[model samples]
Target: MREPADLLITDCSLMTPEFDILDNQYVAIRDTLIIAIGKAEEIKDKYEPKEVLEGRGKLLMPGLVDAHTHTCQQFLRGRTLGEYPMIWSRILVPFESSLSEEDTYLGAQVSCLEMLKSGTTSFAESGGVHMHKVAEATIESGLRGAITCSTMDTGPFIPESMLASSPGEAASRIEELYRAYNGAGEGRLRIWFALRQVMTSTPALITLMADKAREYNAGLHVHLAEHRDEVSYCLQNYQKRPAEVFDQFGALGPNMLAAHNVVLSDGEIALMKERGVKVVHCPRSNFGSHGFPKTPTLMQQGLSIGMGSDGAAGSSLSLFDEMRVFRSGLHAFWGLPIFDPVVIPAHELIRMATSGGAQALQIEDQIGTIEIGKKADLILIDINQPHISPTHRMIPTIVESVNGSDVRDSIINGEVVMKDRQVLTMDEEKILYESGRALPRVAVRAGI
Candidate 1:
């Protein structure tokens, strides 16, 4: 005589962040939330399901969370390779400047398609020009996370297209944006505050935007300490490291998500630890010659680290690619003859993409894990293929072997947005067609 669940998934290899693998378990969803979770055989007949999903060969976990990305840069992928150091000035600036508001929206729309196909259900979009376009795209595509405008008022070599006219203008834009879009898409999207970076924004802009973030009770996102040259610049200008610069403004805390801490020293890491700042590690972007962040050292120090793709510009849109590359990054950290589990185990790596990512955005209590009473943001990866056959352990098989394309289904907020690898929210063919046509226009406009 109980109310029925809208949807039920049975016989799933349910993986939770606490390292519990509930083989042949079931989950129930109703009204944008998980109403029940239990053994599949036990609960198969308990409630009538409007739509029952057979998950016999599927691996279910909280959908992968990209802690930091630039959906607006989705169109610029594969073009800026080998242009690092000068990439921003020579490549990104012009490309970003060339984008119309519609262009930004299309980039976000296409990025969301890639993310959905790849098993990412939630992602924090780093600030970009015309971010309302991002919100619109997120709402249309049915993903969850923060989006923001690039808050810049001062700095050198910044394109006029990206610069705000005044400090007041930047602050006002953030306030207005938060007021308008902070809780859009039924509370899935949060419009947070962002400063382009020290190299682009004046300290005044950072302090103002930081104050605005605190005022609105919103998370502040920024790109910091990505390169050694950035650290040198901070030291010469602010007379401190990047972490010290943020600390001086009282802007280092759980409310802050610092992306790409590849150049932090011992003291800087300690400062981040002392302030409880979370980090988003874009492994592939800072991969190869630039070197990965001192992640093993930081993880040992108890810093909560999350994974990100940094958009098509820096890396792939798939968090699964980031996950595989993350393991490789660890292997490189310890030199030759790597024993993977000794440094960082597979499950812990999985944590960085799930719960760790949610914690980075200060929303762990809501999403990031599979639990009763939590929002049902889940991905079901069909691992019955040749590469992933003989799955001995759930987490290891997922972290080590599986890639994003293996995601057969993606569910956000108890709604099946994608099934059998076909996205239900948007037009994939049209999006692909649009992107094909759009990229040429963008390239010609940016003259890249």
Candidate 2:
């Protein structure tokens, strides 16, 4: 007598938003939202499902969200290792400035496939060129993404081709991108405005883009105070820290999504909290040599924080690795300094990858939890493997032992994008082949 459900996973171990582990549960998906979650007997009696998955040995949880990434940098992987500080100005800019439109699309394909295989269903792109191509690649890959174009009006390392003639032109281009791709891919895609970094951005461009983002209800993405160079640059130019400079430009607000943030004063942290700004921590990307982020401080202040892989160029597009690296780094930096053994709990790490990331992207209402009416973005980790076989503690085991290879299935927007480690939406072999053929050209162009 009841309508048919789209898909159902029966007899699974579910991790709730509150980090509670529930067993012998069934989750029903109808269209893009989760329609039912309860005991299997009641769910089976209530609705007929078109397809059912056996989840006996799997842990079904909300999909991981990558809060910051550079899809266009996949082609430059391994090029920045052991390099000097400020690789963005020395190597990253030249590499990105030389990439063709096709190259950008290929890069996105590589990054999206990696993310999907690693259990990330959604990501927020930091900034890049040919974002339309990036969006097209993301839509084809069946992943949710917040796409943005790298906008710059002034400052050094300004590639002649990348620098905008005027701040107005840069803002106009961002607006065009938003209008074209804001809700593309059946609302799985969002368009945000970006400033590449403080050193490369002007006050006029910052204010204009912020206004446009507020107008469109989109978020503003930027790399803020990632290292001492950025902080020193802001101080020399604007006589304030990076966050204060952004605030003076009328750019810091609830809609701002700041990445890195490794070098912030107490005042800057307080200012961010007061303005309700969201923060993304890329531990592997920023904490290698420059400095560590004030994540514990940010967490203590109740600021919404998320995790990111940065990209494959220097780091990787895997939240699993990010979690391990973040946990280990936090233990050494903040934990040892204060002599506290538990700086960040394992469950909190998982929450940052899921619900906290969703909050940062302003999509918490639609995704990030295994609740009714939320989007069916979820992943299944096969715990039947050897490493995780004797899993006594679910959260700690997932944090310390689980790798990206353990993700067996991925579902986004009510569709199975990957099943049994095989991706349904992308041609893995074809992408690798094309990347092999194309990497040489990109490398030669980039002079790497």
Candidate 3:
């Protein structure tokens, strides 16, 4: 008989939902599942594992999850930092037109490396074209990702590949991608349909994409109401707001994942909550945009809120950066004394980046928390740094002090994809080199 996964991580501080700190604990893993989590002495006594890993002076928490991203945009980092929405659209569309399959793969690889090192084990991606390259990179990186190929039908700004000739073609391509990669990578990779932007997609295409997503029981990912111009365009063209138009097309549901809902009315927020549609709050992207509305009001109204880095162009694909931006934005929006500024408590921020995001993606039961029977997806943070000293409150210290360099080990599906800050699946040096080579080409095509 097999040894039954004989792996044990002992003598660590475990952060369970029930307890703030469970010191000197052990987590047992078998195959791809977490078999046990309890006191170190008790677990060591119960099952004698073939291999034991020491976790002394480390903190073990659920792996971070990014609810929204554009993995293929990593090459565009620092290029679109100060541009407006229209300028961004102009730059992005033309740049995307020049991306080859190799460029997409390289970009995804670079982004995945940044994510893994930063303690994100899973993420949902919204990329322009080259969905296959994105999927391949995610699989090779040993990270769980929900990949969506951007789809559009009628937009003066979008590229040709994103827009199919007709709604039927759009639906067909989405179904083909879903059938090919939805359950691939041993369930580590999922496929979803992405409407590139609210104004970019037609009403008929939106409804058809939603129907296709429902048929496959997959999530519909889209960018909605990120800027005032987008909302105004929708209002001018459709005589309704972006969210209302989505509602009219039957696109707001539990299976929908909307990004950057920064300009929503009270009714629109309520409608989103009522329909169980999840929103991803990308503070860094909003700050970069310079005109995003307040999101704390929507958060307070009991809407499912998750965190995302947006993309390299706006947020740099770093969850730590996103958390810092979220903290600052919350403090600015909700003043001190009465509100405390720390609207998202440290523990809650971690949860938002992990379980909250999984819930938004409807994958909570599989890989969110560090519970038994869940996937063994977790990160070990080296809390021995000077900034993390006086560790009176571990969670808060981690959220406020720690950076991506503090992540010592990253495990997903009982597999160690990164150890001691070294990525195991892909070559980081090569990715950097390829990205450097591809950026000039992208910039030229984008007319920057």
Candidate 4:
């Protein structure tokens, strides 16, 4: 007889990268990896599964990946929703700086639950002083993340808690963080180096970080060319564009993910393509910021681009919402009589949320897709609702019709983190209750 699978999912309508639906399919997981997948009838007889999940009336897809987000900011979700200057200077800075380790842990607990409920299995956290606390929460929540330690040494009015004081101090701290948590949580959690941004980071700081990332074959995440003021500062001080400074410092590479690349020049885009630098687009977050990255143009130029929510402040932890917003967002903004309004198809949006994000994190071969020999990171979305009726056509319905709340179950690393919208690893009710209580304390500590 064939080997027994640790878990089995059958009768699922599998969503493919080509946007086709494979109805009545089955997937088998052994340990933490996908061992087999095929037609439901065929696979059912092939393996003896310890546990079986009837995936009837559901859609199975590779779990979503948020290529750029701040778990640290989940604590201040609705507390700050004003304009840019105040959003950054008065709110974001103080709020982040004021987080105690416990407060940060609470943020991670709730945010990870939010993502699982919304169908995100993996995410790239953009580093914060309290990021290790986020790491602890991920370990407890069974979320896969490329998390980081926030290393900011300089910037105007930066809070003292996040300041590293010098390049050496920042480098040492990064090394310590990496050694402690780089491959923690049974290889589900990764520790990447975060530079914060160009305005605050010195060349030495990022250069050292680049070397360290390369040495370990890890990815680096940072904001690049997001704001107009950032670009102006780079030109004034670095004698080049913001992207150019990154290029010169050896920070622009395949493993580097630059978030909110809103102001890329043609040459910079070409340079990014040449360097294999990846990008993360935060559509909701960009509404009041500079502008959305020229995604259509970037896609044409052959750059690997992914989608991000930027956490609760920038957007919700829902890549489902990001997908709809991003697809419509692209056309409604600049395609008026200039080009086809439907330039980006729903299929492309799905790719950006999955395989493209995998390439961005330099883990394309591992967890992004639901293929045999890949880690078992997947979610099941319930489509037995009125909103997603007319099941004859599933792709567009999944893309445009379905929302994050439709995600009914989630499995990560061969573990069912959630079942029927109930999170299995963490205490969902307690996390929600504590998040509300911590918000006021965080704000009070920040004196905002």
Give each model's whole-structure lDDT. Answer: 0.84, 0.89, 0.81, 0.85
Measured with C-alpha atoms, the lDDT of residue 360 in candidate 1 is 85
- Per-residue lDDT tens digits for candidate 2, residues 241-345, read 999999998999999999888998889999999999998988798877577888888889989999988888887788989999999999999999888978998
Which residue segments of model 3 deviate by more than 4 Å? 1-3, 48-51, 290-293, 336-339
lDDT of each residue in 1-448, candidate 1, tens digit only: 6458889998988886688887888999988888888885567777788887789898889998999898878888888777756676677766887889989988988999999999898998878888888888999899998888877776577777688998789878877778778788888999888877767777777788788888888898988898877778888898998888887877777789999888889998998998889888988887743676788889889999988888888667888788888887777676335555557678878899999899888888878899989899999989789889886776777777898989999899888999998999999999999888889888888887
lDDT of 3: 0.81
lDDT (tens digit, per residue) of candidate 4 on 1-448: 9788999998988987577788888999998999988986678899999988879999899999989888888876776566556366567866788888898888888889898899998999988766668888998899898988777888877888778888888877777778888778889988887788888888998798888889888888889888888889999998899889988898988889999899988889999999899988888887656776788889899899898898897668898888888777787776655778667877888899998888877888987777899989999989888999766788767779889999999999999889988899988888888888878778788786
Candidates 2 and 3 compared: the better one by lDDT is 2
TM-score of each: 0.96, 0.98, 0.95, 0.97
Candidate number of the best lDDT: 2
Return the candidate ranking by TM-score, descending: 2, 4, 1, 3
Query: Which 10 successive residues of model 2 have the least lDDT summed?
Result: 153-162
Supply the global lDDT for candidate 4: 0.85
Q: Which stretches of candidate 1 lie over 4 Å from their true place?
A: 335-341
